[model samples]
Target: TLNSDTFTVTKVYSDASSDPQVGVSLACDEGGPPVTVTDSPQTTTGLTADFTVTGWTDATQVVCTATETSVPPGYNSSGTCAAALSPAGGCTITNTLNSGTFTVTKQYSDASTDPQVEVSLACVEGGSPVTVTDSPQTTTGLTANFTVTGWTDATQVTCTATETSVPPGYSSSGTCAAALSPTGACTIVNTLNTGTFTVTKVYSDASSDPQVEVSLDCDESGSPVTVTDSPQTTTGLTADFTVTGWTDATQVTCTATETS
Candidate 1:
């Protein structure tokens, strides 16, 4: 019959900056002390060279695995364990880290020189919101970039932008859709509050005489109406108002009536 044998388990890191701590569990024909590992730039703990177990029957096999509890930030505990082992056999497990990048873009529909615009970004990963500020008035448009390191691959990362400050005469565009991927793009568009309205003048009588020199006045207290011809155009007028006009003809002056 063969004498008792020994087995060992080792831990390693692809990235030295990854988790510094590792743990292990062993099931063997010959029991041993609790196994634990800690990683460092100089040396990684817990290997046959670093740590070893003794007293297993000569041909008896040993099964070992890396425990996942308390994994370090940005590191995966899913490191694979080496194949089943026997006398004098060794196994190695490796921890991994993740990384990626994303972009954010801001846009305005009108050519207005708004002050600096600020957007807020957040993630479900439990970090504080990141603020991205841009002076659209100076840049014409704005784009920002972000990089994520140590996040698990395939882990859903979401980023959203909200307008914190706006230019004069503008309102917030609200929040945008949460960015779907690490490489995804988030865009926000702001619209000008001011718009144009068309005014058309209709004559009840076509024979009213185009040269009657009709004087048009708007009810907006300080607003001025520009008189050109039959259909005079008013500019820089805001809000709703009533239009009043008069003809130079004395005969029709008294009989002139204002209609909507």
Candidate 2:
């Protein structure tokens, strides 16, 4: 029939008519060019058929998230959105590799004085009981060659207690050397008690011309004491007297009778 030849109304050809569009439109808003995902194979979901880039004239933003190949009903392919201006955001992916390590030595310090005594240490990477310095040893019997207490840590470290003559009751050996060390030599000390002596003279003049005597006195408690010329050595409180002569107190008299 010639009516079937009428430029078939089966598909109308008009630009402004109720007809299906035969071509895409270039009329887009002033927003963005758009993001094109050419490698995605989820084209089965017609909702993901197209994507529009919005709100960024500066640069395109991509959010990273996990997505499904076959999307379920009422669900859209989504990922975490951009929280800040960071690079990680909307519609992107990521993969992390192995990690690394960084190290820095820390100094030991105190609240007030930082680093007092020298704390020298040697150690391995991950081991206990670090190597450190040890203290000095003890000293004995080094005084003036007889008693030793302290010393310097040097060669020939000799000390002295000076007055080496060890008086009685102090020590059998003298005082230590000024520079005392552990390995000092020993010396002998005088064991006998030692002192001084003096001599005095007098007649019967009681307290006036008092006799000079380092000898033994009357007693420990006796006052206005008397002494003998022959000084005597005594042990502690012990006393002894030697009286060979004395002025006779009864021999002198005042005679009032005239003599012929």
- Candidate that scores best on TM-score: 1
Tens digit per residue, CA lDDT, model 1, 1-260 = 32433345555665664344555554433235423222311233432233344443433344544343344565665644544345335566656655455555667766544534465555444453332323112323475555545554323656665666655334456666554353466776766443222343345774433322223332223333222232333332222222222111121111112232
Off by over 4 Å in 1: 1-20, 25-49, 53-73, 77-96, 111-117, 125-141, 149-155, 179-183, 197-260
lDDT of 1 at 118: 64
- Looking at model 2, how many pairs of residues clash? 27
Best by lDDT, which number? 1
Question: What is the per-residue lDDT of model 2 for residues 60-87, given as tens digits with 9 covering 90 to 100?
Answer: 2332122333322212223221221123
In angstroms, the error of model 1 at 153 is 6.3
Question: Residue 184 CA error for candidate 2 (Å)?
Answer: 3.2
Which ranges of candidate 2 are over 4 A from the true structure?
A: 1-156, 159-174, 178-183, 186-193, 204-260
